[model samples]
Target: MEKILTGTVVLDLTRFFSGPQATLFLAGLGAEVIKIDDPATGDPTTFSPPFAGPEGVSFHRKTQADMGIAYLKRARGKKSVGLNLKAPEGRAAFMKLVRSADVVIDNFSAGVADRLGIGYETLREANPGIVHCSLTGYGSTGPERNLKAYDLMVQAAVGMMSVTGQPDAPPAKAGSPLSDAIAGTFAATGILAALLHRNRTGEGQSVDVSMADCLFALMFDEPFDCYRSLGLPLRQGNRIMRFSPFNAYRTRDGWVVAGAATQDDWNALLRAMGREDLAENPQINSLSWRLANNATVDSLMSSWTEPLESAEVLRRLNEVKVPCSPVREIGEVMEWAQLKDRDMMMPLWNPLAQATVEAKGPGFPIKFSASKAAYDTPAPLPGQHSREVLMNLGGFSAHDVDAMARRGIISAP
Candidate 1:
C-alpha cells in the first residue's frame, strides 16, 4: 500500500519521549526522519534501561553498546546523524538540510531552540515551507514556559493524579506517562494540520505544544463544567457519579470491568448475572434509579462477579452483549491475537544485535483501503548515517564531509 507521507522529510532534534514519539508517528506514515543528535552523548535514553540485544541479552546491565528499549520503541524508521549543533559549521549544515526538509521538531525548554539559533523564525527563513514544531513543558508565551515538567509533575499539576486511583488511597499518578504521550500525539496532529495548510498556501508555521497544556486540556473540560455548575469537581475513583456499576470488580482469578449505561444494558447485565429479580425491581430498574442507589447497584454487581473467574465473567457478560472485559496485563496485551492480526505489533531488526526485535507501532489506526503506515526501519546507531546524509542530502563532497568530521562539526559512522 502507498504510504500517506511517502515524500516527506523530517529533521528530528528531539530527545526523550514526546518529540521522538511524534516523529515515530510521522515515520510510520512513511516520512524519512533523520534524527540529529549530539556527538558527545547521542540521546541520553540510548544509555538508559530496558535493553534489547541478541535474543536473551540484557544490554543495560551488560553493556552500553546496544540501544535502550525506550529509544528502540520510539526511534523506529529513523536515520541517526550526529552533529554539534552549537558549532557554526554544524549550524550552517543544518540550515542547508532545513532547505530540503518538510518538518523540524524539538522538545527543548522554551527559549533553548531560539538560543541555539534553530528557532522557527530562523528555520522558516531558510525554508519558508518548513513546519517547525516546538514541544515544551509549558507554552512559549506563558509564565510557566521556563519551568521544567516531567510526566508525573505534569499529571500532578493538571489534576490527572487527583482523579486517579481509589479515594481512600493518596493521589496516584497513572501507570503510563500520559502527559508526554498525549502531547506527542497532539504534536503529530498539529504538524499534520500545518502540513495540510502549507500544501494549500505554500506557507509553513510554528506549532507550539505544551505538555502541561495538553494535560490541562484533557482534564479541564469536565472539571470546568463541574466547577461552573457546582463550585467544585468531585473526584470519584473508578466510576463517575453519573453512572453506577461502571467500575472494575474482583473475580475468582483476576479482575474485570463492566458497565451498563442504559436501562436495556442494565437489564442485559442483570440477566447475564442470572438476577431477573433485580432486573424487574422498580427501585433499581432504570439507570437514574440505579445511580441514586449506586452503592447498592455496585454491591449487587460485585456479588455476582466476585465468585466467577474473570474469563467466565467476561463470557457471561458477552453472552448478553453487555460491554465488559477482563482487565488485561501488559504481557497479555502484547500477545493479544486480535492486535497481532491487525499488525499493531511490528518487528524490526536491531542492528547491534543482528536479530529481529518486536515493538508496537501506531497500527495505522485509521485504515485506508489503498494507503497504510509502515515501520520498515529500525532505530539507527549514533551517527549511523551522518556521512551519507551530509553527502547525499546536504550535497557535501567526500572531502568536505571528512573535513567537517575532523573539525568536530559532524560525526561519521
Candidate 2:
C-alpha cells in the first residue's frame, strides 16, 4: 500500500523538543520533512548535554553522539539543511524550498517568523497550498504571547505542578517534559487536520499551537469541573479521589501499584489477597462507602502487601485480574519487553561516537496495514546535508552553494 504522506514535502523550521517532535511525527507518516537549522549553533539542544564527550565542552564527540541519538529518532526519513535565516541569501533559499513544499513548521518566539518574512501570510502568498504551522509559548496574539516559556514553565502555568507531588509538600515539576511533548502532539494533530482540510479546499491554513494553551487544554475535564463546581482540586498524591485501595503500596522489595476502581475489581483484589471476610463486608462493598473509609481499606491492603515482594504482589494481583504493576524505574523500563515489542525503544549507530546508542523511538499512534512507520535514518551531523539539500532540492548550482557558504549564509560541518 502507498504511504500516507509519500508525496508531501514539509519545510520544517522548528527546533528544540516541541517543534522537532511535531515534525518528526509527520515525517514518520512518510512526509519528506526538510529540517532547517542555524548554520552556527544549530538547535540549542545540541549544546545542552550530559554527553559522552570531554567535560565542560560544546559539541564534543560525546555530545554529538547523544544529539545523534535524538536526531536519529526524530529525523528519520527527514533531511537536514543548515541556513542562516538572519541573512538575505538564506531567506531566499528558504523561500525556494517553501514554494515547492506542502507544509512549513516553526517553533520560534511569537513574531520571529514574521520578522524573518517566513510567516504564514508570507509563505501562503508564495505557495497558497502550503500548510503553515507555528508552535509557540503562548500563541501568536495574546497578552502573554511575548512571555517566554519552557516545559517547566508551562507545567507551572497550567496547574500541573500544583496538582503533582504529595499534598503537604512543595509542588514539584514532572519528571518528564510533559508540556513540550503534549504541545508537539497537539501541533501534529493540528497540522494533520490542516493537511486534510487543504486536500479539500486547495487552500493551505496556519495552525497556531502554544505550549501553554495545550497544557491548559489537556487539563480540561478535571480543572473545569473544579472551577465550575468544586473549588480548585486539592493535590492528592498517588490515590484517585474517587477510588480506594488504588494507590502505590510498599512491598518487601519495592513499591507496587494497584487500583480497584469498580466493585468487581475490588472483589478480585480482595480475593487475590485471600481476604474473603473483607470482600464480603457490606461496609466496604460500595464505591462510596469504600471511598469514605479509604483510610481503613488502605491500611488493611497495606498490611497484606507490606509482607510480600513487589514482584510477587504484582503476580498475584495480575493473576486475580486486578489492575496492578510494579513501580519500575527508568532503567528497568528501558529493558522492558513490552516497550521493545511495541517499537517504543530503538537502537541506532552513532557515527560521532562510533558506537550504538539507545533512544526513544517515534511514537506514531496509528498503525497502518501496509506501509509501516519505521526509523530509516539517523540525525544529521550539523550542516551534514546543507550543500546537498540546497543544490539538489532548492535548485542551486555548485557555484551558488559555494558562494553562499563563503558568505556564511550556509554552513556544512
Candidate 3:
C-alpha cells in the first residue's frame, strides 16, 4: 500500500532536536525529506557527540568525522543535502530546490531566516503553494523569540519544572527533552492539516510553531487549570490535587501505581486490598471523606502493598478491575513482548558505528488501517545526497554542481 505522504518533497532546514524530530515523522511517512545542512559544518549535532561509545559516553573529544548519537536517532529516513545558505549562490540554489518542493521547514532562531534571505516571503515567491513551517524557541512575533532556546531553558520558561517532581525538592524537567519532541509532533500535525486545506483551496500557508507555546498548550490544558481551581501546590508528588489514594505505593520488590477516579474504581481498589467491607464505611467510604484523609488512605494502602511483591500487587489489582501497574524499569519494559510486538523499540542503523542497534525510540505511534509507514533507513552523512538532489530535483547540471562545490557553497561529498 502507498504510505500516507508518499511522493511528497520536504526541504528540511531544521537542526538539533526539535526540527529534525518534525522531519523525522514526515520521512517515516514516506516523504522525501531532504535535510539541508551547512556545507561547512553540516548539522552541528553530527560532530557534537560521544558517538555511541562505552557507557553511552566518550571521553575523547569528538572530531568532525563523528556523528552524534542524537542525530542518528532523530534523522531516520531523511536525505542529507548540504548547502551554504549563508552565501548568495547557496540561497539561489535553495530557492531552486524549494520551487520543486511541497513543504519547507526550518528551526532557525527568530530573524535568522530573514537575515539568510530565505524567509517565508522569499519561499512563497519561489513557490506560491509551498507549506513553510518554522519551529522556533518562541513564536516569531513574540518578545522572547530571540532568546536562546535550550531544552532546560524551554522547560523552565514554560513552567514545566514548576509542577514537576516532589513539592519540597528542586524543580525538575522530565527525563526526556519533552518540549522539542512535542513541538515536532505538533508541527507534523499542523502540516498535515495545512496540506488538507491546500488540497481544497490550492493555497499554502505558513506554520509557526513555538516550543514554549507547544509545551504550554499541552501542560496548561488540564493540570494547570486543576491546580489553580483547587488551590493546591503544583509540585506535590505523585497524587492528584483532588483524588485520594491515587499514588504510587511501595511494594516488597519495587513499586506499584494505582488510581481511582471514580466510585467503582475506588471500590474495586479496596477489593484489591481485600478490604471490601470498608467500601461502605461512611467515615472513609466517599471520595470527599477520603480526600480529607489522604494520609490515612495512603498509610492503609501502603500497609496492604508493602507486604506483597510488585507482581502480586499487580495481579490482585488487575483481578479486581482497578487501574494499576508496576513501576517498570525502562530497560525491562523495552524487552517486553508487548513492546516488541508493537515495534516500539526500533532497529536503527547507526552510520557512525556502522551497525544495526536497538533503542527504545518511537516507531510510528499511530497505526493506520489502510496506510503504512516505513522506518528502515538511517540518517545520512552530511550532504551525502548533495549531488543527487541538486542534479535531479533542483534542476542543476554536473557543471553547475561542480562550480558550486568549487565555490564552497554546496558539499561535493
Count clashing pairs, candidate 1: 0
Query: 1 or 2: which has the higher TM-score?
Result: 1
Q: Which stretches of candidate 1 lie over 4 Å from their true place?
A: 55-59, 63-65, 224-233, 357-364
Q: On residues 1-413, what C-alpha lDDT tens digit does candidate 2 reach at each position?
A: 56788888888888778998888888778888888888887866543543323222234444434553355556666777889988887899999888888999999898888888888889988899989999998889889998889899889888888888877789888898988999999999999999999998897999999998898887655644554354334666887776887888999889988999888898898889898777667788778887767778889889999999988898898998899888999899988888777777666545466555544554566677889775456665667788887877789999999898898899865
Q: Looking at candidate 2, what is the lDDT of residue 328?
A: 95
Give the clashing pairs for model 2: 53-62, 72-379
Name every residue pair that clashes in candidate 3. none
> Global lDDT of each model?
0.84, 0.79, 0.85
TM-scores for all predictions: 0.94, 0.92, 0.95
Considering every candidate listed, which one attains the maximal lDDT?
Answer: 3
Candidate 1 C-alpha lDDT tens digits along 150-231: 9998998877887787756788999999999999999999999999999999999999999998888877766545643743
**Candidate 1 lDDT score at position 335:** 82
Candidate 2: segments with Cα more than 4 A from true spot: 53-73, 223-233, 358-366
What number of backbone clashes does candidate 2 have, counting pairs of residues 3 or more apart or in separate chains? 2
How big is the RMSD of model 2?
Answer: 2.8
RMSD of each: 2.1, 2.8, 2.1
